[model samples]
Target: MNYRHAYHAGNPADVIKHAVLAFVIEHLLKKEAPIRIVDTHAGIGRYDLTSDAAERTGEWVEGIGRLWGKPLPAALEALVGPYLDVVARLNPDGRLRFYPGSPDIARLMTRPGDGITACELHPEDGASLAALYARDRRIKVIDRDGWLVPKAFLPPKERRGLVLIDPPFEERGDYDRLVEALGAGHRRWATGIFLLWYPVKDPVAVKRFHAMIAGLGLAKCLTVEAIWRPVDGERLAGAGLVIVNAPFTLAAACRAAERPLWEALGVANGRLGVTGDAA
Candidate 1:
């Protein structure tokens, strides 16, 4: 509970994760059915790039700051357009002072009748999220443990949507909890799309986490990783997502976005990999 996203709101990790998330939501929208999105560990719905927290780290300079007004290649544009569109809408003045969190991205991409259930355990953040969507009938904000969301809200009545598990990972056994949560959630909603976000500070720990997920034997499970820098010491080099039951188009979309993302972020040794059945 000690983790707060305000400091890292628009970092490179957020850029990659949110870009992929937008693509996933875009694919889901192709179908005419109403969808539901559950954002576990949802931070405040949006962030101010000028806030003290963000300015202190200046991480956005290496992230969205680089892509703010640049033109993207055709392939990269197609993959990240929806996400950028949302960012644009939020910053109508053409300034990049605001950033949307995952829940905000989901809210922007969904259509009428579609809904989002955002659970935030942090009291202040939860209250902020609640107020952000308070007037919107389609959103339901919950103040609860994000890990418990799969068990409590899985197999949504709509039967089709995305479940985003993005924990703080401040506690020991968070990785283990993630695996267990996915297994339990899959058992309850076998067809639901599951997207898990994890930081890559240690290559060895990441490998172990992947092995545990692979042991789950879920079909169509895919691990998409963006390594911005070499994993050395305690610093976060990059981030990754383990997508369960990913859409067939997701792998290509991620591949298309990776090059431009790394180029814009100024990462000379960046690499993108898709592993598992979805590869």
Candidate 2:
């Protein structure tokens, strides 16, 4: 995979994805039960915003940087505390220098008794991730195909868990892979939370993805899309996040968060919406 999350680590898209991810994971923490997180396509655990890769992209300036100290919508503010707190921990005195990837977020949320598994196919990122999170016993970093692992390790021993399928959509087969993986995973563990991230470049792919979700017959599947700008030709200018077996209260929070996120991003026609169960 040519996609290295370092280039886009702290971008607007990462802000939305990570914020929501933290929200959902925090919501899962209400119970006294232990939780496990499986992060497929997990990139480097953390990124230094000052690094050459991040400086070259400078996407964070348009993303998390804009929302740093601003007042967030109540829904988002409430749901994103755990995530923001970790982000805060990474930057003492409230300075944004390091941006945490999915694995970092998982490690942050996981308690002493919790467990985490991160899979990365990219060699460099995988190696970096292993090194970054090496000291955390609760976390396991693997250089392997994420799609295959879900089949091998379904219904985690902890029983309560989340599977994040964040593949690099650098190829056409990714959509099919997502659907196929979701279908197989759902069949294996219907109750396990599954999150799929995809780029919103072409309307055709978006519609097809929606149709796939609709046909899944999952009572609680939810889809959220946030577009920063109108599509330029057939290229993606935004992203979509789909959660199967989503939390009871997350949909409303996501809907309510749209306005502020769009406003903060300073982008026109920035749209966000919910599909599927209201709860």
Candidate 3:
């Protein structure tokens, strides 16, 4: 995989995705039952912002750096508190020196009995991930393809949890593979909450994804996207997260979050919107 998350960690898209992810995990804490989190395509748990990769890209400047210490809207701030708190803990002086990937986020909120299975395919990243949480009894790090692992580790042991699929869309076939993965994973663990992340490059691709999910005939499905700017038929200007069996609280949380995030990180010509059906 040519894509190294270190270069893009904490970017605007990561900000939105991780913020919503934290909210979902927080909501899960409300129930007394044990919960597990299965992260497909998990990257290294953490990244040093001063490293060559991160410094070369400097994407965080428009992301976390944009609002690190700013006053956020009360609702958005509350929803993103857990995530920001973790970031703060990582960068104690609030200098934005470290950034956490999804796996780290999952690890951060794991409880005593809670379980987490994170899969990373990149040899280097996988090794770093394994080392990052080696002593954590609640987390399991595996070097393998996340899509295939979901089939083997479905309906997690706790019987209550979330499965996050965040494949690097370096290949065009990813769109098709995503559909297959979702269908297979759902069949194995029908009630499990599944969150799939995708980039919005072409308008047609986005529509196809929407239609694919709608065609699934799943009743409680939601699609939320934050567009930083109009697609120029070139580079990716935005992305979306498709949530299946999403919690009712997430929609409002996402709605309350889009604007502040956009105002903070969006380009001068950018736009932001969140929409979906969840009940």
Candidate 4:
């Protein structure tokens, strides 16, 4: 209940997570059918970077702030272009004033036929989310425990959609809960796409989590990690995403950006890697 993403909305973690999300959504839209997007722990659908909380942290200054209006190698640009395009769409004045969260990204990229379910546990955040898309028939906002959303909303009627379970790790046992929630969701909708975003604070814990995920024997699971800081003790500086049923092109695209993104963030002695594979 204490975690508010406004302070960290466009930080490096968000940049990576939302970029990957946009890339996945782009790929998913290529097929000629409507899809659903469920975002557990969806914060305010969009953020104001100039807000008091955001200025207090100024995290975006080093994150998306470094990428706007910049040129990149065509290859890397193709990977991150969708996300940057969304930001540009919002800030038509040529200033980075607004940043889009996962729900907003989905709203921008998805077609009219697509449906989106945004869930937030925090009362205030949930109200904000609901208000953001109040008149938009394509989106539905739910104020419920995010952990329980998978079972309730899994196997979307569209039968082709993405389930993004990006929880705020404010409590203990989050990793275990993620594994359980993922399993339950998969059991309900085996063919659906699942994207799990996690912070890379404890290398040991991450290693164990990866092993446990591998132990699940998912047919096609990929892990992409970007580290932009030195190996500090239980300090969250980097981000990781466990993408189930990730398109091969999406995996390759993410891997292609891992190093470039690390460099773009303007840092050294940092590392990035993509493990696992999908067909």
**Which candidate has the highest lDDT of all?**
1
Candidate 2 lDDT tens digits, 1-279: 678888888888788788878988887788989999999889998999999989998989998888777776675675456677888888997778988888888887768999999999888988998998788889888898998976888878998888999888888688888988898888988888898998888878778888977777778888888887777737567898898888878887777777766777788678887777733
Q: Clash number for model 4?
A: 0
TM per candidate comes to 0.97, 0.96, 0.95, 0.97
RMSD of each candidate relative to the true structure: 1.2, 1.4, 1.4, 1.1
| TM-score result, candidate 1 | 0.97
Error of 4 at 107 (Å): 0.3
User: Candidate 2: deviation at residue 164, Å?
Assistant: 0.4
* Range of the 10 consecutive residues with the lowest summed lDDT in candidate 3: 266-275
lDDT of 4 at 161: 85
What residue pairs clash in candidate 2, if any at all?
none
Local distance difference test, candidate 4: 0.87
Q: After superposition, how far is residue 41 of candidate 1 from its true place, in Å?
A: 0.5
